[model samples]
Target: MKDSAVAPTRVDGYAELRDYAVIGDGRSVALIACDGAVDWLSWPDLDSPTLFAAVLDQARGGRFDLRPKVPYTAARRYLPGTNVLETTFTTASGTVRVTDALTLSDTASLTPGRELVRRIEGLAGSVPMGWSVQPRFTYGAHAPHLTRRAGVPVATYGAEAVAICAWHAGQPQCTTDSVTARFRTEVGTRALIALPYAYQEPLVLPTHAECEARLDHTAAAWRQWSDERTYTGPWREAVLRSALALKLLVFAPSGAVAAAATCSLPEELGGERNWDYRFSWIRDSAFTLDAFLKLGCAPEATSYLWWLMHASQLTHPRLHVLYRLSGGTRAPERTLPLSGYRGSSPVRVGNAAAGQLQLDTYGELLQTAWLYTTAGHRLDADVARRLAEIADFICTTWRQLDAGIWEVRSAPEHFTQSKMMCWITLDRALDLAVRQLIPARHADRWHEERQAVADFVETRCFSERMNSYVRSAGSDDVDASLLLGLLHGYRPSDDRRMSGTVSAVEKTLRQGPYVNRYLGPDGLSGSEGAFLACSFWLAEALARCGRTEEAVSLMDQLVALGNDVGLYGEEIDPASGAFLGNLPQGLTHLALISAACAIGEAAR
Candidate 1:
């Protein structure tokens, strides 16, 4: 809700991550900077090549700019319970309000496959406004061929097209790679702009009336979805906002929730720790399924589990660390030529962690299935067979080193979290067999191996001097991820070892509400900010341990950490309070939801 009259503060032409809010239409999302620029958007789908990525490269990445020509300070918020954002600008001349949304499709008209609608209204004296559309295709690698469809300006690249339909605004004049316009608004004036997009199909050049109706309908639809949410807990506002943010990351067509909206957002300024988080991770499975069921998103919960099984069939019984939104297995890491956000170079597109051997994934998947079945959802015969086989696979695979939950690039090691999750995998498998959800012929072997895994974790992972479980087999350092060992029932909250581990994590890895992933080397050259998800995990662990007052105090601070629009990024710089990674981060929101629910339950 802040920006100076001239502009939002920018360093090297990049707005602060916290100064951005996101809007989406299930299929795609747009990152609109506080100063009113749509800086990042991947068209047609969440994981597709960018149509606007100024967040990645200021000079080459395209954007849609809209703001008052005269200097104006701005304040913004989501329009009630909806994702639609309303921004108000106050200049000396007058005040103006703008509504922004990636409009949802409607059956009342020939709606677009994808559409971004912006509405502007003048409330006081005259205010001059300006807008421009700079269309760059294929991650800013291709300049679109600009033309006109009937009276509207159109940008085309191969089979993809975008037609700009505007009314009561200025005449759009096309330049080489952009279209610009200028206009003035008096009291009670209204204007609208719509970008109707097409992919491998004919463009839908929407009418002004249809665009206006669609915008209204989209807002109503969002409100309806929000009203249906069942979470009636403390911090309901933040929890619901996180749920909306999570919805944006869900690829609606496939039911796979993406890890984040944009890619290559740096974990540290001018650092090589930048990564692409567009794919869904196996580690988020348990929490995602849990949150969906808790929020009464039953359809999403079912599709998510079905999507998980369907996507991993290609690599059956062996889960990749992550999978593409469309259920694809491969994500070959590649870099773009453009300079990254704020000069963080090698802007990457794909995730290399997809190929890593993360033993924690097996436990996460099995836990998800267990949760699903416990919620009264049935696993079919085929999926039941695969779950049993995966448990069997873990029996032998748990002995190998793994990249672990954080996906560290360092040489694989026997991470303590990975070993604990291996134990969870077999324990859940034996439970499923006892429930007769899966075959019990191999239950005896699973039980024996589960004990072996438990023995290894208890004896080797616990540090006698530290009175806590170490990050790896023998190290004394504490890791924030160790908190999951308690959350997932690896150990009860009353267990002295678990309590000591929580204490060690707080002592070694926390400063106030901020929590570092680990203090040790991650095999990367540059350091990263505190992981936001870990901080939320600590809040949940505290609540589970019956430290309700402390949990509430910590959560109060953490909830305030969200930016004005109640959105969180992947990480935060504790020293500066600057968001440090890809925005609308799924894991951070998932952790927030999980923490809020746990704390609410404990307080009750």
Candidate 2:
């Protein structure tokens, strides 16, 4: 081993949520901070156990650091039309540029064995840099043993293995704990580091030059893929960035998109609202498909349809609200031992909402099938039958009380949003049947039930005193989800009742341009940041209601709220503008895309 002459630099306790940006290779993602420390990453797959999770527990959670040793100021941005992250650091001594990416193959598939490439180039005078590679498997439950194989440092813990290769003037010193290195680069000098992970397989070390070449190829692939996006409307940059973020969450092998890359990033700091979002949520996927289809990206929509069909096949054609990326039905929620983000204890894995009877899911699934057909993709006979069965199930069960779209932990209530979505299921299914995309077995019954659902919601969910729809049949509280009524076609955007609900939402849920999912208790103790998606929904609703000027103003503000890299988290603190909850959240990105599209259409 090389001499341990240089001591490791200690990073500050934790990075602000907005200070991190994500890069992925379709299979997994990494959260790299502005200071060039990789604080969270999961290899092999998005749902896989985290290998580096210092974002949650700074002291015990592992990380990989690669940054200038001297004090420096940094600025970062994504390469145009790609997920490649580039951060430039300037110090009194010199300047350096670091480019990071989870390399993709030439065919745009995730590179085999899940490789991450980081390249550092000298921009001017010589700059000293420090680096470390540490792996803590299973959320810090297991520590890997480090050794050198073929002159490349490898870390192994049970069935998992990862190899780190570096192309630098100085050699890395491998201890049992980590691999550390220090080096200086002068003008025209360059260094490359690649880390590839494997499960129950031997590590394959690649030359640093080969890894550097792969980075260029990956960036080209991303640019090519992004060029296929069909949205050329207002806020195009924001829309494209959101689309790219959604692409990062997709498990390419299965076409199942994770709701977000990380789990247990608290919705509220020091709160218990944190839950795993790495699995595919039916509602989120349905909305994602809608956004992709609107952008003329049919391939992603088709891939999601296949994933849904396979998942339904495994579940006997019965749909759960969420499912594992591999099509499994079980997702038992459990708390981990590690300290949560910002002292939020009992970090969670898996989601209990999978078992809840979320009535909105049927509408979402049927709507997705309708979108698929509209995109000119023919559904196989089995898939068609499965979709019909799902619609049939919703027809019979729409009257029952269940969890609402927010996935409340309280006793199921007759949420107005659920009823509205049930109405949407019948409406979209009727359209599909009329188009002959599927057999209209219960056309008359569906028409009848659809009207009945509308009447029931109008009667039971509306509040006379408030002159708007309430959260549920009896409750008088307003929910941001009610803004979706216009988007779902539950009522005309100009209708008095629909307009009344908009007014109610603005009055109760709006905190400037942000909106809370709900003000009432959600069977949880602490408060959460304003849900970013709900605010976008408000903007869409406003545009659809012919409030185009107001919508455009809000759109400008919301678009500017994104991080410097044009990414959003699940929520944002209204007062401080700090990101809260999971970074690069899919639902949030989808909503932003939808809002931008709505604004564009309204403008035209």
Candidate 3:
């Protein structure tokens, strides 16, 4: 092996949003560009401040770079049935394979500390590879001090420390801010790099062989987890990949599923729609429960239910739309000082939507509770009582104006989707009560309110002009969320009204093959990209409405829209086919899985 130090090559601008793949260790996730740059990472935990923020602001944000010194064409994929990412770089002279993963322990559990492992193997002639390891703490707000511990590079920022160890034939040149290494490898040679983070603790460097073994175990664990999934249907690969992505969003300690790994990745480029999604949203609990339950993962549902129960206790069973992973409610929204992702200014840290009164959350929470009980998971007395109280709250407060399901910042309105969900809240609660899943304290009252909500939606929300259900009372605008009426049984897919609503949505909200949330003003200045999840919802609606061929075609298009590694962002630009918003979005994966499952069921 030949060793030398090379000056780091600066990344000129941001990589395309779709050009990154994600790897995680249950606790945190990292986004790696196709060019082998680990650009965005939040270590120790998913919601923690970024340790590497290069993906957001390429010029000032920090990153870890690893790639060939010469020009190369790249192809990447996740190892089958696992989240281990493998990228093959082929140059005119040689080819190399890079494997990336967050290391797991022997039992296939997240390692006690933050550990990222990268392995490279030469497949052809000799190739020169360059790597730079730089640490920027606290979302690039803190510059760490670098030192060597037992010959390994250590980066310390206040109480947090990360140690980097390498196993190769090349020596690394280390500075106070970064470590750079360049090496030439021949056929059959391999190299390894490991970085582990600890909070105010001495670094324990793992041997290269030990790190390699850990990688093998981690892959095995992921494969075993994937193998347990019961979705052996059409688009099994897509479904499994989505399931893996959703699993990555699960913060194992608390079982709170984050909305996405990275915050402030913009829904529209150069727009203010950037918002942090590292926290769990109560509104997502129903969709997440449906996805996980369908994929044969009951433990996640149980854990989530426990978290919900515990979190409800904090606020006296009054649920908010979102909460921190640790069950804290104070996620004050604030803009960071750094320039946003690709000049999308005002990078927001916490989500202000947490305080919004989205009445749909009552329906979502009750629906999740119903799902939990139906899945053979027993709810304790306290949990049952808390759920009952939630339903009671919905009964009394369903008529209040709310921010609706979309969490619009505008004045409250009687959104049709929210009304339908209020109906679902009572409907699911009544169903569970009938089965003695919980005490039917207000069954009669819930029944009356459920019917009242249905009547209100039918009489007030439907528009004869649009020949379909509208976004709100007295409004003629169709929302993509109306597609969810089919899933929630608010309307039969074959009903003429449902058919009309579907047609209206297609006419108004559909843009080519994608679907926007709504065409109306959302109280935001710039327009948002097509919501990927809503597009999936449209596919599901089509499948349920007996348009099998059209649904399959649409589903195929939506599935193919995913990035190379089968991950999707929150939104997509319809014309450019560029991913937008926070990436590897849980809602997108959940919707994809749900739509595929619907299509599979329809086919059968």
User: What's the distance in Å from true for residue 418, model 2?
Assistant: 0.6
lDDT of 3 by residue, 183-298 (tens): 87789999998888887666667778778999888899999999999988888888999999999999999999999999999888889999999999887888899888999998
Whole-model Cα lDDT per candidate?
Answer: 0.92, 0.86, 0.86
Which pairs of residues have clashing backbones in candidate 1? none
Writing each residue's lDDT as its tens digit, candidate 2 over 312-360 gives 7776545788999888889999998888888977799999999998888
**Against the correct fold, how does model 1 do in TM-score?**
0.99
Alpha-carbon lDDT of model 1 = 0.92
Least accurate stretch of 10 residues (summed lDDT) in model 3? 1-10
User: What TM-score would every model get versus the actual structure?
Assistant: 0.99, 0.96, 0.96
Better of 1 and 2 by TM-score: 1
What local lDDT does model 2 show for residue 232?
88
Q: Which candidate do you rate higher for lDDT, 1 or 3? A: 1
* True-structure Cα RMSD, model 3: 3.6
Best by TM-score: 1
Clashes of each: 0, 0, 0
